[model samples]
Target: MAHETDPVGDLTEAQAREELARLADLLDAANIAYHRDDAPKISDAEYDRLKRRNAEIEARFPALKRADSPSDTVGAAPAEGFAKVRHEIRMLSLSNVFEEEELVSFDQSVRRYLGLGADDPLAYTAEPKIDGLSLSLRYEKGALVQAATRGDGAVGENVTANARMIDDVPQRLNGAPEVIEVRGEVYMSHADFADLNARQTARGGKSFANPRNAAAGSLRQLDPEITRARPLRFFAYSWGALSEPLAETQSGAIKRLEALGFQTNPLTALCNGPDEMLAHYRRIEEQRATLGYDIDGVVYKVDDLEYQRRLGFRSTTPRWATAHKFPAELAWTRLEAIDIQVGRTGALSPVARLSPVTVGGVVVSNATLHNEDYIAGRDATGAPIRGGKDIRVGDWVQVYRAGDVIPKVADVDLDKRLEGAEPFDFPKTCPECGSDAIREAGDAVRRCSGGLVCPAQAVEKLKHFVSRAAFDIEGLGAKQVEQFYSDGWIKEPADIFTLAQRYGAGMQQLKNREGWGEKSAQKLFDAIDERRVIALERVIFSLGIRHVGEGVARLLARAYGSWDAFVAAVDAARDQGGEAWDGLIGIDGIGTVVATSLVSSFAQEAERASIDRLVRHLDIQEAERPRTEGSPVAGKTIVFTGTLERMTRAEAKAWAERLGAKVSGSVSARTDLLVAGPGAGSKESKARDLGVEILDEDGWFDLIEGA
Candidate 1:
């Protein structure tokens, strides 16, 4: 509630107490929104800001700290459904190393604790720390009996049946201890995650945000069949409740698990000392995107089991282990301009256009300002946040991407701000529709208040309809698309198909238009006509339903197979709250939120009429099941970068997609191949760092032609 001027020292004890109370309530709601709802209302940076405030108040008023103090808390309480199982040995959290110096300090502390001389060498095993759900498997006589989630580090949800469905989780192990508990991570590979989301959308369901969420949602499924349907994998990392010693060292124990038919990370290696540990970390970081799964950090454990025992445990983590994480994917960039975007839901979003900068190997030129409050450096109640610093044009700003795929400005550097920079005054009217932008009660975003009538909403939706991943009309980019809409040549998806009939019949009509000759006009018409026979997935995506993304669209197409089947299913599933609502809410990834959004879209008479009009104008094709059978590029993920010499990059992507390969914009562990061309930048470097197979324009042509 206070500003930067109200310092911690200046806060009266009562004021500090009040602030703590407000923080606790706010944080509790935020945790619920993030953990239970899977719909986070605030950014991670904002949450951190609040948590820091809570801690500051507590520090200033130690005697006034509440029994439910947030400093001691981790995650929220678990949702009901599964039975709870208390952990025999607490599955603790890990201390983190954000910088190289912190890692060095950690190593020094370990050496000091063990009383080992500087010359004396100690080995530590470095393992890629999977970013997924933590699971503990209790085995008796080498037979798995129970599996549980990490709930508050003390108790967890029992999901033994769900665990059994994971092929990576061994049912039985030979020549093992009579009793033992294997603590490991449960994750979904990037490939599996893509497949899962596609499947979810086929059934008219919501798709998971990331592989970690997909894995967690799958493992936590109430129905064992749902879990079985998902591709879940496990990696054995640590242990608890062992009846007999497994090995002398951490790396050896991992090998023992591997021998016992448990999956352990192949990259896990024994390092001689701190320098070796840091080197391994770098090596892993370089290879990170090629691992086929998500790893947030690298974990280093004292290899010697005896030294580990001597170091013992901290209050919440093992003293012998520390996790070295990448610095927050953040960078400083100049804020060049601000743009407003109106979403399908009518929410007006403020976007920041920045001077090109790299954050986590991705070149970002735009970041989200989130809302007016964020722009004003205030909370919802107009309280100061971020040291009460407001952002302006020509200001040096920090941008970061964490859990979100979008970049967000973390803060502004006032010292680097240019003189005469004006404080951004958020507009009160929608830029697209010229309607009043209204902020509703209890909502952060300012909405256009102009529903379907707003041209901005209509035009934005139309733009998304023809986006690269959607219909991808060859000659119809955003600029052309918007131009056509404004000029009344195209108004809807159906209008795009009827463009030639509407204007092409007359030579002077299109050819005589400003900036259009016979050749270019005819090319645009041909491009539009070429896409008349469209895949069902593209059709679904082009509809521009909120929350029903490409993955969800693909899933829907897959489930229904045919356009007719999908239309009928959605038409019949009218009541969002009814059981016939896609019968999809219970499906992994799709859940209630996604299902409701989808059903609501179809429930609108206007939307249904529009879909019908579009359907009648095209030859709709059924979605084929994933073609992994004998396709050479099947299930492979590839990236296209730089300037291609032969065919265009877009053509290369189309070829890859046709061959059943996933065409991604960024290089990650999932990337199997990288097609680099002249002027290739970050993606190429990252691909090389990830050990992804590099292909020239010629090589790509050969790979596709040969396939």
Candidate 2:
């Protein structure tokens, strides 16, 4: 690229054309990485720089604008897996500028087009540009009709079925326009992402890279039921096209969306000028990391509808809006040391202790080095860095904190090595227990040979046994469990059931301990007693076996249906040899590692005895199967709508499902019946039009026999 000095600030046509093409290519590449890969090659600042450059080039060379330029585009090509749905109205992209000079230039262009001057200030609406997938939802007659993913601006993928699964996407509108097209972003909550990844890893599947990717992948699943299982949320940001005018201003349009039961982004702000826009951008950026979900930048749009129309668009993207991105959160820090820590599952991970540094507002001291290869910073270094090789005690290394939480060492600065800086020596024996630690073939984690005898692993197992999603002994939290372990009241999970028997007289002594009282001690005992008859799935999860999570435990419980059957299967699995174990592998959702872990856990005589002892005093309840008895809706597909007089929609669905019916969200030809309630709208009409059976609250009650 060449630069031309023009004192008069006029660009030559050829120069402008070249700049525009360069900017388009840059933005295209950035979009591909961000949207398709869930990874960005450039920082938000860099992307904004390139986008602003494109706008400047376009401004200077109006005639040289390309039809396919990102400056004139909405989003990248439609992602795979979804059925393409052509947007009723084109979803236009936004123009962008970075520096104050570029923003002023953009403002000047707007003013010039409107035949106004600098003194004629423009008002704008600024909102956080959520780092998520954009979607367009269409409603007909106050009912959700269609939902589409924002594909290449002109067209998108129809995802109505998947969209219906999203709880935040209202099925029916309240005070909605006759026909409205609301645009929003579907995002995954941080907690949801963590849980989803935990389940994924527990199933021996690769975890999603981030929440945005997880949300997109979940939404685009072939099975709508799979998408429904995910914790995906949607927030309306802007409008695509409307059959009827919603509101005069952009803010008003968002307000109307909220009125229609759509969840709008609450961080939107109305600003009177550029200064206020910048202020809002700064405020949003400052609180970005704390927001839970990711946001790359802030979007500023012209508030007035007339002004936006007057400013118009350039081929694809609208000139009425610009994105103000936050500065990059990436930083470099030295890796001080690498320490191996064993998890509850006995999997050891190398944690990098970094020199204290701030990245995206939060102070990060430690970064996960992943495994031995990560610690050694090489592939062939069989000797782990902590095991006396590769990365030394004094070596400069690069660190990164992606979304302000996960700290990771990115690279090593070998040139900054100091003389006599000894290579890290990983202990040959368990740090917490003096036992031979060996790494299994094809496994990076070095396991404690002591197994149940290792104090560290034992305590971790006990903690897992009483976790909230497991047996859930109410008064026996992690802290209390640790205290009881230290006090010799509990040695293992089985010891928990015997606490009252072993410490009945010692309970008075525990009452006098700090934070413990007579009532509290009694409460702990009662809680333990309450959990003596835990559900089969809870018992399976509470066993604290490696590679088994709540979902997997439920799957196992459902497969076996009883504690004796499950135990027998596990015992049989061990004797069946590799092929029989491989036969167990083909079971739905059960992978080789999980199957192997199941068999291996049972093979240990000590662990088996512990489990037997624990269950000796406790009763393992049989998992309850959903009843699909002789209800009218049983074996029928039903859709519930509006407010029910007898029960909440959730309760009604549960009851219907218990009777063996498939509950659908929308009324379709496949729908055997539609349970319409008060204020039912489009679903009622659709059912009536399609000749699908429609039952009112009273009629439904009479049919189900639960009225």
Best by the lDDT measure: 1
Each prediction's RMSD to truth = 26.0, 21.3
Whole-model alpha-carbon lDDT for candidate 2: 0.76
lDDT values, one for every candidate = 0.81, 0.76
**Candidate 1 has what TM-score?**
0.50
- Model 1 poorest ten-residue lDDT run: 355-364
Candidate 1: where are CA atoms >4 Å away? 1-65, 117-119, 330-707
Give lDDT tens digits, candidate 2, residues 1-707: 23423221455677677767767788898887765555566655566657666766766667777887666656677667767888877887666555666666766777788887778867788898876788889988888989988777777778899999999999988777788888989998767887998899888887876677788888777799999999999999888667778889999988888887888888999987777777787777555545667676788888889988888877776778887655555545566777888766666677888655445434455788776665665554454343333565556665566554577776665666787887666767777777887888888677778888887888898888888989888888889888988888788888888777777676877688888888998888899899888789899998888889976787677667789988877787786566456556765558878988988888889988888888888788887654545566656889999889889998998677667677889988989999888878777878999999888999988887751
lDDT digits (tens) for residues 1-707 of candidate 1: 34323678878887788778878888888766654444556654466668767877888889988887766655555669989888898877786777789888998899999999877988899989887788899999889999998766777789999999999998998998999899899988877887888889988899876676688888888999999999999999989889998899888888888888888998999998879989998777655544677776799999999999999986667889998875547656678999988886778899999865545434466899999999989988889989999988888888887654789999887877898999998989988788999987877889896766788888888889899988898878999888898898887788998888878886569888777899998898888888988888888888888778887887677666898787676666666645557466654346666776777777777877887888888998888755555677887888999899888887887667667777888999989999999878778778889999999888887766655
RMSD of 1: 26.0
* Candidate 2 vs. true structure, TM-score: 0.47
